[model samples]
Target: GNNSGNLANISLDDILNERVKELYWEGFRRSDLIRYGKFTGDNYLWPFKGGVLSGQGVAAYRNLFPIPASDIIANSNLVQNPGYN
Candidate 1:
């Protein structure tokens, strides 16, 4: 929208990275990192992402969402997983 065109020297990578930062907190960081091949690697990381300050690949078991006790009590159809409460 701006006619100044002062950033003609900016590289495509820089522009894309800037946009990714702008949309990071809006729930695009995960997909963006996956697309860029940085989600599960040591090169690029964010604080407290995978339960570490420096970021790392999370354990597969950590992906489970534990069912609450109350829900189990009310629903007999619910079967508590072997390793979960």
Candidate 2:
């Protein structure tokens, strides 16, 4: 069915909540949050977000996890993920 007519532009908060509801404890909790800017940043913080109950923004660079040193050392042709050299 073409349900697009019923859909509205969901807010980031709603998206975050939906992720938690649909994926909590399913192993993607952290990744989900990061994807939506909820894991880091004051946009949508949860417990201990920045070491405080109120939460804080993690380094934006952290969005792109660093490539392992071993891999970087082993493959000269490979480049590290963004935010890391």
Give the alpha-carbon lDDT of every model. Answer: 0.67, 0.75
RMSD list, candidates in order: 5.9, 5.2
* Best candidate (score: lDDT): 2
- What are the clash counts of all predictions, listed in order? 0, 1
The TM-score obtained by model 2 is 0.62
> Would you estimate the TM-scores of all the predictions?
0.43, 0.62
Question: Could you tell me the C-alpha RMSD of candidate 1 in Å?
Answer: 5.9
Per-residue alpha-carbon lDDT of candidate 1 for residues 25-62, written as tens digits (9 for 90 to 100): 79875566566666665565678767888777654343
Worst 10 residues of 2 by lDDT: 1-10
Q: Looking at candidate 1, what is the lDDT of residue 33?
A: 58
Q: For residues 1-85, could you state the per-residue lDDT of candidate 2 as single tens digits? A: 1466765567777767787788877888778777766666666666777788877777777777798999989999989887786
Kindly report the root-mean-square deviation of model 2 from the true structure over all alpha carbons: 5.2
